[model samples]
Target chain A: MSNGARNPNRWLAFSASIAVVALTAACSSGGTTASPDTGTGDGGSDGDVVLEFAQWWEPELPDGVLRGLMDEFEAENPGITVELLSGPYASTKEQVVAGAASGTMSDVVGLDGAWVSDFVQQGAIADLSALMDDAGYDQTQLASQVQLDGSTYMVPVVNFAYMLFSNDAMLADAGVDVPSTRSEFADAAAALTSGNTTGWILPLSLEAPNGIQNDVMSWVWASGGSMLDNGQPDVTNDDVKSAVEFIVDLDSAGVIAPGAATLKEQDKVEEFTNGRVGMMISSLAHINTIRESNPDLEFTISALPAADGYSGERGTPYASWGIGVAENSEHKAEAWKLIDFLMSESSNAQLADAANAFPGNTTARPEFVDNDPIFQEAFDVWQAGYPANEFVGLPVAEQLMRDFSEQLQRVLAGEISVDEALENAQAAWTDEF
Target chain B: MTATLTPEVEAADRQPTPPSSRVRLRRLWDRLTPFGFLSPTLILLIILMVTPIAMVVGYSLMDRVITAPESNFVGFENYVEVLTDPVFATAVKNTIYFAGVSVVAHFVLGMGFALMLNSPILSHRLKAVFRTIYILPWLFTIAIVAVLWRMLLSPNGIVNYLVTTFGFTESSVEWLSDPNLALHAVTFINIWSGYPFFMISLLAGLQGIPRDLYEAARIDRAGPIKQFLHVTLPQLKPIVISMALLDFIWTTQQFALIWMTTGGGPINRTEMVSTYTYKLAFATYDFSVASAAAVIVLVLSMVLAFFYVRHQKSRD
Candidate 1:
């Protein structure tokens, strides 16, 4: 054995390597120890019940208003501190999911109504019936939407109902009426479309959660067609077929952009903002965004045009991002207390300010616009609304609807036939459901 | 007084140890030393690499939900689902298409460009500057590149502006929305980011080959093409394979650029396995299904790596 070659340095290398491995494991495992400090409570002894609120992707709500409300809550509670924690938007679900699965859910977490059923099925949520009752909340004031096994899983939050928002100026420029009926709306959209403008900005892509069916539904319900003749895809029915065909016909007649299938949710807003679109159907959530882009521009919100037969038909929107407490929360009393604070008119007002949505609580509506006319108009739409039907909202079902919309776009693009598109879509959904 | 020491001095100088004892000590030392040498790296690998892999495999085996804590076992179903699902199938197809075409392009054009720069007539400083500039894209975040391309490829983009100005067409292209063109657009960005590495590696390989080989070829009346085919290509084979394999794996797992540019939309034409898996796990909150899809992807990746290692071994 050569003296230098057979070295004592070997042990040093071995020990160092072992240390590296140990550290790497510790880092990669993400060291779980009930990350309890995640925004529900202030960790310090300031005599305040510190609560943390988290959201992802910079969901900026009106800060000054929320702070004012939280401050008021703190003043009343004496020793309670409320903190807002912003998390990554996409990964917020991951954290909450991982947390809930581990029985370590935050005191309050924002759950999308779309997956609220799955969450309930997985036993991840608390039934809020007792809490609302205890808090003296008026159940009748709640919107009559979203039936889940004959009970509501969660209450509404800031919402975006699919209403037609158009530049009133643009409509006038196109020589189109404010479309009183379905056929007229199509003709109006057609009359308005030009080289730089699309007539209507109904969702042409399957991926938009605001499904093309709803655009069709605006007509169907307006036209006396049933979405579900009780828990079945009535899309094969003549009313649904005709409504879909009408949309497809609009596209063929050059009302929609040829590249409409790829249009993102943001594009319609751009069209409206740029005054390039005539009349567009979008959620009221975008009112601020469009307003910001063209402040002086005049726009109006209207219900989806009526079908000839039905007296009333409106675009139905599902609720998104409702807050709920953990069923088995260690801080159940504290949690309920916090939830009450949130549900209070002031908190609702803050939420309306932050998320630009209709309030879950009824009295919170007036606080929204500080008595502005625009807020009153929004309040009207909320009154006219129906909760998004939950039975057809199996995540896969929504995905299938999206796939169906793509096929619809294809038919409109003249890439495929209407019958072919529908047939293919039916096959896709049948395979899924 | 001379060179020979006194008996006391000689005895003080050293003692002769037992041969058997010395041998035993040496054996123990050798055994202990190797473990000492390897323990650090072995620990790191086990902790960092192997543990996460094991965890992924464990997660894949379980019926995990997004908001669920305790997970139960579900075997082979993820693989079946991944193999059978249309979205997954499309993802696999697109990933292969992206990697295959991109790597091939990188190999050919990268080597050609590097060779042109490697020429003696080009000043070395200028060549170095060009090389650095070419490699700049590699340093940029995928998001930035996606955004840059988004602006450049939009219907009202500079590239479209240039084309329209040059009378290519009356209207600008809806590049990303067109399924036929979207993958190509993504592929072009990938090539821009990837080719520099191929060029650098091939250039390094080219420099390692003796000028004498070219001289020998010249003596044999070899043309530049013949010389390259015989001398240059053979030497660069190792670099090409390694680069291609690397580019393949990177491109297969590439997510950020595509996700930013398009959410795998326009009928999911751009949906890779990675993005699809992400959407499943994160967006859909179907972690079990996502885990299964991910595990399938992991296995496919391993298979590709295995082929690469085997190829390297065979070549050696």
Candidate 2:
């Protein structure tokens, strides 16, 4: 043998080159070979239609129910297939933004209700009412949430309404009943707060934008202050000012958690479930988790407390996670089929119960309510809840929510007066509009 | 050698024999080969770093709402708006406070650790172990550190548990909540996670310093404190300055730790420039304003770097 053949280094190099080639070959072939049958077709041969549904669920939440729905849909419709793309809820907005920017968005997307109006304004989502009508689906049976400005751009399969959740045991221990008015609520919170526990806790973290918006907006609405009136930012509304004053009072009185401004919804929920919080405004979806966290903890759901001497419907801010077809999608018909299947009376109830939320279909609501006895009151409160599609119709809605959160934090921290904070926030809102 | 020649001709002759054009071309090719090899990376840097920065500068001059389809040129408006915005002022103030305090804390703690680790009494193996242990925090991801610190500082968390258990105070302190303390709490976490980088760098500098200096100091009967002041500090000046400069830059740009923890809240007490810019971009979807803020941050960093480099050269 020649010197090169005898050399171990030469042999090693040859082996490494072979290995690299093999690895490259394997990597290139892996996806197609391993999941040949499960591959997403690009509306090509074999008469296959593949639709990608992007959502924040199917990752952390129990996905068995969603998987069953997809399987049933696929079985019923042999030619069409549904692919689930799951990601963390925190990254939902970013993912959608990037997807839209790159023009590679999923065919069907489960958008946060807050994002729906913005998407509609940007023409990022298609009008789905026509599709719904063509399928002989009664548009009236759809949740009021799906209809924005008398037109439906999405279909909410399930929903979670933000409402007041009280630790009945803690309230009783403090010698206070579930407060139905702002003053009573404040009194209850102040009375209950002692030791390591806070009287009233809501995740006020500006980092958790949705959490802040859901909890804070309920107060403004309950005080009969519309966030936007006639497409104008309305933070200077007297009712909103009073709401800010109430929040500041709560903070100064030390009824709220010490670092409540930095806590997320999950943190606040953890505190509540662990018997540390007396009262909190939370979503109807958390009932099961709260029970699981502490079986002995007695809690009651109630409508948001109205302002004193005010007579209006209680502010129940329920957000529905709805499915919308991307405007740029190629397989719009297939995407609608998947959405239609999920929102079908049968699938809607199952998905809602599985996800621990309310059904968006009116037909499915009764069955879902019947199944979950604990969430019955929450459902009823949500039934009379403020309409979802109204406030967020403005393009400035998100900015308005963000300004409210930041300014509210300032007010709570006593860095600024309620009037000043509200005025500054309103100024920002006005400048933007 | 006897022939008188002009300076240019003489220099050219001394360089080498004037080659044929083909040979000159080959020589030029040889001279340019290394740069030719490096051009790809240079191009990548230009494409990746320079292009984006230029785009940001361009965007700063536009009226770009992130998700909106339309963006008209609005020169200097974004910058004017951002500068006048109270939140931007708060962010700048918070960034300075965070970076200033955290950098000082890191330096002090890092110097202490480095001194201890560099002590002559410890075996090499023991020093290695201690070094590894100290750098553990640096090895952990910022996300993990943020989560860990959050859990520790939570009202019902173990830090409170220990505080109550040890009877340090009757009540549990809200470490990340109080506006007065939230910035400090986040600074403490930043210092804890970051000091290791300084310590390791300073320790390496210490090891490189000759033992003769310390011996010379001892010969003059200089005590430990005096030696540290005169010998150790002077010897470590270059490393200290370099580390301090790097730490200042890193701390100023820090986003995740403060963002994941307080989110510039408790009324924007801990709102750093990075977090504020992120909020403007992602949360508010006002990328033009964010770009303006970013340009300001970039300019501040460049000015600091320029002064640092100039000072370093002056010292040399």
Q: On residues A134-176, what C-alpha lDDT tens digit does candidate 2 reach at each position?
A: 7766667676545567788867677777778898888888899
* Cα lDDT of model 2 by residue, B117-152, tens digit: 999889999988998998899998888999999999
Local error of candidate 1 at B312, Å?
5.8
Per-model DockQ: 0.20, 0.19
Q: Candidate 2 docking: what grade?
A: incorrect
**DockQ score for candidate 1:** 0.20
Q: What is the DockQ of candidate 2?
A: 0.19
RMSD of each: 7.3, 9.6
- Candidate 2 has an lDDT of 0.77
